[model samples]
Target chain A: MTAQSDQTTANADRIIISVDAMGGDNGPSAVVAGIAKSADKNPQVGFILHGPEETLRPLVDKRDVLSGRVRYCDTPDVVSMEDKPSHVMRNGKGTSMWSALESVRNGEAQGAVSCGNTGALMALSVIRLRKLPGVNRPAIAILFPSTNPQNFNVMLDVGADIRADARDLLQYALMGASYARNGLNLKRPRIGLLNVGTEEHKGRSELKEAHGLIAQFTDQADFDFVGFVEGSDISGNKADVIVTDGFTGNVAIKTGEGTASLIGALLRQAFEYSILSRLASVLAISSLDRLKKRIDPRRVNGGVFLGLNGTVVKSHGSADATGVSAAVKLAFKLAQSGFAERLAARVASTVELTQDAVELADPVPEHQKEGQA
Target chain B: MTAQSDQTTANADRIIISVDAMGGDNGPSAVVAGIAKSADKNPQVGFILHGPEETLRPLVDKRDVLSGRVRYCDTPDVVSMEDKPSHVMRNGKGTSMWSALESVRNGEAQGAVSCGNTGALMALSVIRLRKLPGVNRPAIAILFPSTNPQNFNVMLDVGADIRADARDLLQYALMGASYARNGLNLKRPRIGLLNVGTEEHKGRSELKEAHGLIAQFTDQADFDFVGFVEGSDISGNKADVIVTDGFTGNVAIKTGEGTASLIGALLRQAFEYSILSRLASVLAISSLDRLKKRIDPRRVNGGVFLGLNGTVVKSHGSADATGVSAAVKLAFKLAQSGFAERLAARVASTVELTQDAVELADPVPEHQKEGQA
Candidate 1:
């Protein structure tokens, strides 16, 4: 084991991650395999796996690395992909997803990981862990593969809530910057507001207002505001963190993923076109593998729920062992760094800054001023 | 010559497409070369090249295919990439972009092609050619590389006007369907309203209203409404034509382009990683070439400005010879199909249908009905 893992293992308080084991497409086996992989990598990490014990016990027993590192929370139900968030919120108490999050709520785990329905997960999280102080709406932040030195850029509001006013956007910038600081190890992440164009006059009124709000809080928030960034800059090195309303952010990321998938499909067809190219593919396997790894969605397979009281990493519903492991790794890292507490502190200061800026922008009349009285 | 080219060549009056020759990254040389390529392929097409004659004449003389097919309209001023649209609208009388649109305005050319600033081109087109009757706001439509049998899907309002209401979206659905009919030769295109999710309950209020408005007009609009589509559907076969607000559309396309470019860059790096990969790249040249050609933005380099009095194809400002040629070809095709007239007719009918639908929905209380008197 590495010295870092040894140090963590030697510590009295080992980090435990809450994981929903039944909701993923591959079921509890893949989730168990994923946790085993995480256990092999980090000796200090433990899992509070939630699922039907009969189904998950056998899978966990098969993995040697997970022998004693896991604790079970038996639950009968699973949140299917099609379950409505509202319906699930009311009736999801017996589900594995709810049990998984309960561990985090009860302080049994530092963070939670789930591959359940995103809507249900968000709803359950809001009801259980609750939103951070002064946060109007929580945002789902994702790591986009980019040209930055860090190899990824943080983008927020990828669809927690579709509508974000100027205040919400400002909070996203604050939370996203804090995410970059902890998640990507950036000292002072540059925050860019996503817009149709980079020009100040472009985009809607809310965006313009958000621009001013985010810019005003830069100094106190401890981040650089790169003004407005175009969609192209999401994967470019212009900013370390990109902020936008959930509606636009969700669409932009999905569009980017679709385009990448299309290119990959096209490339596969091209290589299989001829016998000579087939032979060439063998020789180019390592290089192609490197390329695939560089842009693999599986490697960065976690969408973090930001602005919440606790950290929750939502793995892709269709994630395999590799993807699930990546999510676990992310959840473990956030837990180790105490990201949620830091984020809460960052957001709390941001809310205070916003109040100050608002007062400054719209000064109270001298006759009605509270201090004057 | 092919039978198609011979048929066009034998026509009494050849189609003249106005070409703005000064603003592309490659300058007049690329524009002249591009038109020359178009001239060689389409015997029915001629060009009224707009720029300084001294600069363009030599370039045109060098291409034998362009020998009498090109007509120069000397305009001394050039619209630079950085020129503001508002400023250009007022002071761009003598510029190449303005002169190019003027040809279309005066019926000297059937359509116009510009490799100038998008804002300037859009601004000038609005001023010179004007909006088609009943078009609240004009939209810029582009063909995206997709998995459809046609290998392209039409997406619109990509930076034409950022704000699109339910009515504007409905109009876009009409105009986009009409474009697909002429441009892609789809008899009945499937129109999808771009949103954050495919569910009826998702997205903003305007999208929900647009869904209803578009569904009501499907039969009249001569298209199939696919309800709401997520950003992934842009390149998927779920819809043939995707309609969205300019802000979202613009951002989505740019994000797609950026992702594609990033993959291409990563592929290049992978090939150069080692000796084995280098040898493999040489052997796989044909395969790589095929893949590159399939996704090359240059091959699909035109954004058609719909809902205008005349068709205007906006080539990328950074477009090279090949890219410019694609724009000219699109302009010629649109001109040949009388796309402007057909689109205007479609929009006019859509407006009438919308009015009828509105009246039906809000029947002025029975006592105050229009026919009461």
Candidate 2:
């Protein structure tokens, strides 16, 4: 029938997502398994695995889920986590990470996912895809897991650049709102600007300026702007999107990770402190497992590099198959939603474009005549 | 017979610690309970409670621990948490918070502790006791719990001044190291400068200059200098003192508090999910209580403002009797150790004093500064 033919054609022309299948803590096998798992769950998704053909082909073929939907690019080199970004940018032509980005640039894939070095991946993406129009500094956005199981709070400028002016912050707010709409299915996300104190007159001068500019966009962007949130609001159920300069956001992320690890270690110590405690741990382990599942960092392991011409999801370097699968699924969703083009359109519609770094500088007015006493 | 008389006189002349007892969330009774608890454990400690004698005398008389070591400094006003610092400074003559600081300034007490408004307490202390000669901006230091049970890792510039230059950071290192030496009994504490990256080449220009300046003080100051540390090292045992500008430190501190609170909520939810889990929680209640006590925020409830002429410990405004007792204990330890004078001497020993905010501007010659050419 005509319906069967249409379905075959649709399957043949599936959305291809590229993957750098090497350089993660777990080797190429984990990457292949992750792709297979994603492909099984998502029939409309296919992969362009970028790694050595000999290494990837056998691992990929073992999975019945990835029979006809997989493709290989036959890359010779792997971008190791220890390799410097500058070095990779200059000398990494045939690396799997490089090939994956190239696939995105060549339009063979909608986006790319990499489990290699974050710095290297970012460098390669910037070099290949360039930045979107009206974006001064490209920022990395991440979904912070919240109380709501179906949604997450979006935070931007996580670690892309350490500095941000009022203009850059304004761009981040716009970009982050667009992301929330697409990724978290929010029609109008609430945005908050992070600061030391919540009082109206607190924080630095730049933050004050940013606050006014962000407030002006609430009506136009169809979002609610909650002014001057503190560090406590980042993890709590406050705003749907939290914005800050990269330096503060990056430090906060690392600190949260360290604290979570510390708590986990302390829990082990508590459970093993005595024989009776150990017995209690056995009975309570299932409840603890649910709690652990709720806060698992691996479930939300990808950092999306927003404001770029093409989307790139950077998986954690230490990710295993489960973590890698989570990242791949995120990439697939972004590609499926046509998020990059929508983001570009939204940014283009905004009037304020480039940063005012040059325009705002006082170019000491033309040789004023002074009267001597 | 001479030694016995001296002991009697020494008991009568115990070190007097001034406290603002009116404005804590738990009220004057909690403050009285805390002072009594401290007095029971420390016979050499005496308190000068500043509040209305009519309201406080009955509470003080209720405690057997406060029978002989208490003195009342009745004040007509109480500095509420909502009182602005500037308003308090201009019109807070007879306030209990003001009286406590005045006692420290007049040498009637060695140290002062308050669970009132932090900004008001700081303003009053700076106005009355003055800043140390070589100190440009004072900082608030706190002890974060760590791997070693005997000591804690010191973090400074928690929320005193939001801005800091290279010299200011170096000064924090010196002051934080001094605090570690006195508070934790570490002879030569290891110091680490907080940064976005661990590499020497990373972070802002001011941080780069601070790194070189701190390196020069290892032998003269008697400490180990770990080059640069990321946020993950804050709780880890990488260094004894972690120094940063106040803005970053304050945000990190609040973020840690928020995250810890979130995990606590999640843990409670996990344990209450079912009937069997609730029974397991009953059996494991003691172990969990010990774990909770180990990480209790109330246990370490004081933040000491360093680099001032007199030491001031700011307790949490909502502290209960146990929390107040912890703050009083910290105040007693600092007063007993004569930390203020030793810190002044240490700061004076360093030749590099105030921050050079203006002198270090634009070292590059004008000839190289081409714009339109």
Candidate 3:
């Protein structure tokens, strides 16, 4: 049995995931349908759905694949997309989002999935799941489609917090590397610090410092530290993991998505431009469909919250049934692999390694060092 | 005659643009061919080419379209891609980049186009032409293909300077709006402040301040302020001008390009996947070509240096003859419209309006304000 299953009350044969069933644009029905789709494909998966019982029970009953494997944690209140994180944290006891995270907090579920407001979800996750021992700030890590052999690259701190100091960036590198290892099944993922340029002297001073710190721990952490990478390298094969401050990462992620969406729209316009083009589009339907499937944003739907005590996956607020299913599948895989426990251990060991390195370099007693300053 | 022609030494009927014919990846031959193409299409355009006489004379002479319309300013030195901006500024007097800018400074050309290193070129432009009065920092504004009727959106501070405070961002809005007005022929452009979210309380403190500052000047500037816009709106029809700090703008620009390039690559892969797809590719060649042209980066190849005393267009360093022609065409259009003079007047008037508004709001003397602080 995995470390996560040891703590959970769930059956040894099944992995239980706590899911918030409300607040998505498509409503509870889409969430139910998504979980049902996941359950039908993965026999080892079960769910504890959180929402109003009357609303969710009927939806769950409609899916035969979800029978007997689903449990309900009914909470009437739902977090809206416009809700403030602070307000949600203060008066969230009866909310479905809060109740969903309760299952993970109490060790009843190994992982959690939510399609609520990202800020509120992140706030609640931090309060309930807590931070890993060595983590300063938690980050949102998402997988981006790329030309790598694995076909995806992991990028972190997409919008967890806007500010990251040198130490925070170093932790991101470590956390991002661990996520790639368990999430993408890479043995030694290459970690890259995102910058304006590849040159060592370019970018903010904190990045330069983070570069040295990340390189120092690469050998001990079992990840290759590729120096600095530019924005173009985000979708390239140069690095398996890209780390940056949340502010820059958030802008980069949104810009990339916007560009892709625009290209897709323009391509449709192109196929319908002329009669000959329309005929060609009809003949090329299967070819175009294959291309569409390859770059489909729905297939890569979850932003996993890293540096937390327990795993939580945040689905897009506007996610459809397919997008929610993708998130659920990702949560299940991470749970089965005991990603949370592995990440905790990885961070704890790195902190210890850093302290030892600091002591060796400075050659000063910890107590006496304070007086020197 | 236009305002640009009234100041230039060349014939009033011809708009002369200084062409830096060195430092690009393809060398002076490509630059000469690009100018030749532009000259053939535009009978009223002339060139003052800057490069080594021995190398550039033959290239220019080979193009019959450029005969009797090209003047050479022989400069033996060239700036390489690896040269630092500071180093270039101190020792780059003999380089083609400096000579090209000199032509603009001396009123021999209305604008200058260069495919040299961006840093060195920007540095040289600033040193030779200087910044417009009341403009704290200059910016590099590029045109992005968008869903607007004009087919492009203007984004500023792509990498002129990394940090933009409230005042700097406000200036970006003014400069970007002016660029849209003249470059895209928009009567009253809609400007948006780029942030992580559209909410008023969402981004960094500077963005919030910039939002307020920009809104105050919209009526006086003859543009509609669209409040906060996210990265997705960079290519959306919500705004024609997007303004942000150079750091965020640079990342957003590169991310958009990288994503577009990735999609293009994936499309090629999809069409080559099977026998039926290959047949469809042949049939849909024209349709696909239309799509390619619509979104082609080469077609929109210039990043105009805004808030400068003179017009300077920076082409992509790896640009080909077609790309170079596109940059030259953009420079010619901006010169014909006398964009630099119009932008300077717009900024000057806004600065005066701001001082008047501040005086009216506070009712305090500028000399006595320091004592109050």
Residue-wise C-alpha lDDT for candidate 3, range A1-373, written one tens digit per residue: 0112222344456888889999898899989988988998988998888989889889988888887778888788999988888999999888889988898888878889998898899999999888988788999999988888998899999998988987788899899999999999999999999987787867788888888788888889999999999888889899999999998998888888888888888888988888888887887888888877877878889999999989899998888888899999999999989899899999998887766554554468767879866
Tens digits of per-residue lDDT, candidate 1, A275-315, equal 99999888889989999999999999999999888999999
Q: Which stretches of candidate 1 lie over 4 Å from their true place?
A: A1-13, A361-373, B1-12, B359-373
Question: What order do you get sorting by DockQ, best first?
Answer: 1, 3, 2
Superposed model 3: Cα runs more than 4 Å off: A1-12, A355-373, B1-12, B355-373
Task: Supply the DockQ value of model 2.
Answer: 0.58
Over B105-216, each residue of candidate 3 has an lDDT whose tens digit, in order, gives 9888899999998888988988989999888889999988888888889998888887898888888999999999999999999999998788887888878877877888
lDDT score at residue B27, model 3, on the 0-100 scale:
92
Residue pairs with backbone overlap in model 1: none
Per-residue lDDT of candidate 1, residues B1-373 (tens digit): 0011222343348898889999888899888888888888888888888888889888988888887677778888999987889999999988989999988888878999999889889989988888888788899999999989899999999999889998889888999999999999999999999997788877799888888888898788889999999888899999999999999999999999999988888888999999999999999999999999998999999999998899999998888889999999999888888888888888877776786665564456766665655
Query: By DockQ thresholds, what CAPRI class is model 3?
Result: medium
Better of 1 and 3 by TM-score: 3
The C-alpha lDDT values of all candidates are: 0.88, 0.82, 0.87
The weakest ten consecutive residues by lDDT in model 2 chain A span: A1-10
Better of 1 and 3 by lDDT: 1
Clashes of 1: 0
> Candidate 3 chain B, which ten residues in sequence have the lowest lDDT sum?
B1-10
